[model samples]
Target: MWSGPRNLSTAMMYSFAGRGDCAVWDEPFYAAYLKATGIAHPMADQVISAGIADPARVANACLGAIPDGKPLFYQKHMTLHMIAGFDRSFMAGLTNVFLIRHPARVIASYSKKREAPTLADIGFVQQAELFDQVADRLGAAPLVVDSADIRATPRETLGRLCAALGIPFAEGMLRWPAGPKPYDGPWAPHWYNAVHASTGFDEPEGPLPTLPDAYRALSDRALSYYERLAALRL
Candidate 1:
């Protein structure tokens, strides 16, 4: 699954990992992206040290055999991490699903974690680009699932997603033991506290959060890209 930060990507990863048949990977390209861009993040040094900084090696590993010989590999990817110079060829060999939230929500949530996010920092533009790349490669649009829909009606939403991916929906996907998993990246402490405290998807969100004017403007810039994929969501 491809998504921006502050989306429900981690919860979704936990959901899939709850299915015993699947092996989950969390943000494989993050270190490589940080190393290449030299961007300072909350845990930049530790994340780079703990992760594979070589994009080529990361790509190769992504296409390698599933860990533990599992029947399914669910890789949780951050679209923004696929910056320039990273190879996207491995993506063609796997199912690509885009997970999106409203830009206003993304901005509001993301700003709390990393202040003053730009368009690139939130991953909407990169997500759209990746979606188009996959769609063009397959001669059709790949699967798109909204975080809101997943929160509101997880069983039905995930059931549809599983069917599209040619997999059976396991009831286990709806819940998991609260706390971080072994697969979480080193940066989890910085970004995953809320998810770690949850056992499953939360109730459907209330009205969108109010944002400062600067953030509201940022959301406006990302809205089009989000809407493009959202319109095609399962």
Candidate 2:
């Protein structure tokens, strides 16, 4: 369960799901859950209009298939999607990995689409806190990984991730035939970039896109919490 937005979340999904031995469920709760609840999300209008409204059924489907040939399942999740009645207990039986990116980069990518939402509403602070809460209760502090590290030192970082999850790192996890997946199918044009064009992990030294003033301000403010979580201190 990697919780984040536009933070290589989709790419990471392909990386894990692409493996011959793993099964991937991309934000399974999104479409049905959003439709049934009609919950006002950050971009509630856009979200509900397009995806699932009943998330429980998705959960049921994943759990039901677990005993079969499903050795490992990588489920993509949105931090803000943890609305009322969305029971997270499904996490109890699975390994949890929390994916995080600097809020600046996240919002910058998000701002590219319709009705650009705010940091406060994106649920960054609350998500980070809830990640800790869920991880603590589940008896495993999630192996949180930085998106920058995943891009910069992918081999070593992914190797570490696989180790924490008790799996052997495979070369396929590091490289795939570039471009989108079934999930990336719908969002291709709106958020896709040449960066997302390739399937393998590439060096991230290129100039990132320019951001809005609101994003910079909110990112600077929200970063304090992320700093505490990902940084090592005495």
Each prediction's TM-score versus the true structure: 0.99, 0.82
Residue by residue across 1-234, what tens digits does model 2's lDDT show? 656567788778778866768877667666665565555445555555565566776667757675338688777777766666787776666666677777777777666663557664455775677667766796655678888888888888988888877898988887777666655524455555653677776686355456677677878877876676576211
Off by over 4 Å in 1: none
Candidate 1 lDDT tens digits, 1-234? 999999999999999999999999999999999999999899999999999999999989989999999999999999999998788999988889999999999998888898889999999999999999999999999999999999999999999999999999999999999888899999999899999999999999999998999999999999999999988999
Q: What's the C-alpha lDDT at position 197 in model 2?
A: 76
* Deviation (Å) of 47 in candidate 2: 7.4
lDDT per model vs. reference: 0.94, 0.68
How many steric overlaps are in each model, in order? 0, 13
Indicate the worst ten consecutive residues by lDDT in candidate 2.
183-192
